[model samples]
Every structure is written in structure tokens, then in C-alpha cells.
Target: MDEKTLTISVEPLEDVKRRMLASLRGAADATARHTFASAELMSRTLTPARWNILEAMTGAGEIGIRELARRLGRDVKAVHTDMAALVTAGLVERTAAGKYLFPYDRVRVHFEFGAPAMAA
Candidate 1:
């Protein structure tokens, strides 16, 4: 089985329009891509603590809140709250067994700042 991956990026509105047009023209497949208008917005949502949670969960298999907290040396309540945010973001899911898991086996984050001249 292939490991599913989530791509995170910071892009402008024009890039979004370009991609939409390409998809409409049948020149590209409309794959799911998560984007934020700026890196600051992305960082705000994916905080350092949450990033650690995700790192610990990816490919680690389903894990109960207590166990996940133990692995991170964090409080279960805190982990639970972070888990909820991740779930809402569609980055993680809860199992019937009361475990949380990052559905994707891998995650890719991409960001680039064009030259200052192009920033205009």
C-alpha cells in the first residue's frame, strides 16, 4: 500500500486561480492541496507543539491519548485539545478504539519566497 501524503504550502490568490483554470481546462488533475495565504497563518495553526504531536503520530500507528501524551512527555488533556484541532483540520482522525492517528503516512511542507523584486 502506498503511504498517503499531505502537501502544505503558502501561496497567493493568483496561484490558486491558475490552478483552478488549469483544472478546468483539463490540463491538470485537481488533487487535494492545503494552502495558507502566508507562512504566518500556517505557523499559527501548526504550532511547534502540534508539529511535535504530528511527528510522533505519523506512521506510529493508532495511539490512545494517554499513550500519545506519554510519548511526548505532555499532559493528556493538552494532547487531547491539540488532537481536536488536528482533527478539525482534516490532518488526523480518531479511531473507534478511542485512538488518534494521522491518516497520512507522510507530510510534505513547501514554501518559497520569490526574490524581493517579484514580491511586488
Candidate 2:
């Protein structure tokens, strides 16, 4: 089977807008990307718990919240809360059957910090 990949990135809002415009114009690449306004926001959204959830769900197929919690050895309520945040971030999806899924087989993160401007 072909691999599905998702890219997570910290990008300025303008950059995200440009990419969206490109997509509307059919000029964007096929890879799926989820962009955060800043590294801080990305870190806040993808916490360690959420990251663990993602790791557990990767290629694991649709799973109920209770089963997922059991697999991760976490409380169901806590897992559910993390799952809700992930779903809001578009990193996770809730199926019609009320199961959760991380559709991508792989995840790639891309970001960089530019050097500060030199003072005169």
C-alpha cells in the first residue's frame, strides 16, 4: 500500500495564507500540511501526551477512546481530552462510528528560525 504522510510546521500566518491561495489556484503540492502560527503554539497543541497518542494511533486503524487509553496506559478521560485537542488541530479524525483515526502512516515536521537582524 502507498504511504500517506502528514507534515506539521510552524509558519507565519502570511505563509499559511499564501499556501492556501496556491491550493485554491491548484498550484499547491499534494502533501498534506498542518501549520501553526508559531513554534510556541505548535508546542502547546502537540503536547507529550498528544504526541504519545499520535504514536499509538499511527497505522493502527480506527480505535475507540477506551482502547486507545488502554494501549497507552493512560486514563480514558485524559486520553479523550488529548484526542479532542488533536482532532481540533486536524491531526486526528473522528469517524462516523465514533472511533478515532490518525490517517497518515508518517509524520514530518518542518520549521526554522532565521538569524536576528544585526544592530547598526
Candidate 3:
């Protein structure tokens, strides 16, 4: 089976708008992309605990929150809270059966900082 990939990036809103317009114009690629408005936002959303959750879920198939918590050795309530945040961020999905899934086999993060602007 082919490996599914999710691309995460920090970008300005204008760049996101341009990309959306391009996609509407049929210039879209097959890969899934998630863009954050800024690095700080991305950092805040994808915290270390959340990253651990993603790592555990990747390619793990649909699992109940309790099982996921057991696997992570975390409290069910904490896991559920993180899962809710992840679902809201579109990084995870909730099945009809109420299980959680992170469908991608791989995650690629891409972002860069340009040189600071010089004042005249």
C-alpha cells in the first residue's frame, strides 16, 4: 500500500488564500496540506503532548480514546481533551463508531524563517 502523507506548514493568510485560489483553478496536488497562520499558532496547537498523540495514532488504525490513553500511559480525560483539540484542528477524525483515527502514515513539517527586514 502507498504511504499516505500529511504536510504541515506555517504560512501567512495571504499565501493560504493564494493556494486556495490556485486549487480552485485546478492546480491542486494530491498531498494533503494543513497550514497555520503563524509559527506561534502552530507551536501552540501542536504541543509536545499533542505530538505524542499524533505519533501514537499514525498508522495505528481507528482506536477508542480509552485504548489510546492506555497505549500512551496517560489519563483518559487528558487523552480525550487532546483528541478533541486535534479533531478541531482537522488533524484527526472521529468515526461513526466514535473511534479516533489519524489516517496518514507519515507527517511532513515544512516552514522557514526569512531574514529580518532592515530599517532604513
Candidate 4:
């Protein structure tokens, strides 16, 4: 199976603009990217609980919510809540039978911080 990755980043507005223009010109790659204006936003959306859910679901095939909660040793209600957020974020998908799953075999989060430029 191909090892798909999810890259998370704090992208500046200019970078977003450039990517938008590239996509408009049909020059953007097919890779999936999740960007946030700030790292705090990313952390809030992709919480540790949600990350655990994603880790358990990755490449695990379709699984019912109860089964997933059992595997994660978490409450069904909590898992369901996390799954809902993940689904909304486009990180998790629901199968035809209403099972939840993550299609990717791998996840790689990318976060970077650069020093502010010195005065010219």
C-alpha cells in the first residue's frame, strides 16, 4: 500500500496566495495539505485525543464506532466526538456501512519555525 502522508503547516497568507494562483494555473501537485494560520489552531483542532483515534484507525480497514472505541480503550462517546471532528477535517472517512477509517497507511506532520529576519 502506498504510504500517504498528511502534512500540517502554518502557512503565511502570501504562501496561500501563491498556492491558490498555482492551482488556478493547474500547476499544483495532488498532495494533500492542511494549513493553519497559527500552530495553536492546529493543536486545538487536532487534539491528542483525535490523534490517538487517527493512529488507531490508520490502515485498519473499516470499523464500527464501538469496535474503534474498544480498540482505543476510550469511551464510545469520546471516540465518536473525535471521529466527527476528524471527518469534518477531511482526515477520516466513513464507509458505506457507516464504519470509520483512515485510508492512509502513514501520517507525517510537518511543523517548522524560522527565526525572524534581522533588520536590513
lDDT of candidate 4 over 4-115, digit per residue (tens):
7666688777888899899999997766677777888889888999888888877787889999999989999988998999888777888889998787676777777889
lDDT, model 2, position 34? 89
The TM-score obtained by model 2 is 0.91
TM-score of each: 0.78, 0.91, 0.93, 0.82
**Candidate of highest lDDT:** 3
Off by over 4 Å in 3: none
Report the lDDT tens digits of candidate 1 across residue range 1-114.
977777778999899889889888888853447778899888988999999999999788898999999999999899989999888877778889888877667788989986
Q: Give the TM-score of candidate 3.
A: 0.93
For candidate 3, the per-residue lDDT at 47 reads 95
Summarize candidate 2's per-residue lDDT along 65-111 as a digit string, tens digits: 99999999999999999999999988899999999989989989999
Query: What are the C-alpha RMSDs, in order, of all predicted structures?
Result: 2.8, 1.5, 1.2, 2.2
Clashing residue pairs, backbone N/CA/C < 3 A, model 4: none
Q: Backbone clashes per model, in order?
A: 0, 0, 0, 0
Supply the TM-score for candidate 4.
0.82
Distance from true position, residue 92, model 4, in Å?
1.5
Give each model's whole-structure lDDT.
0.85, 0.92, 0.94, 0.83
Worst 10 residues of 4 by lDDT: 1-10
lDDT of 2 at 118: 100
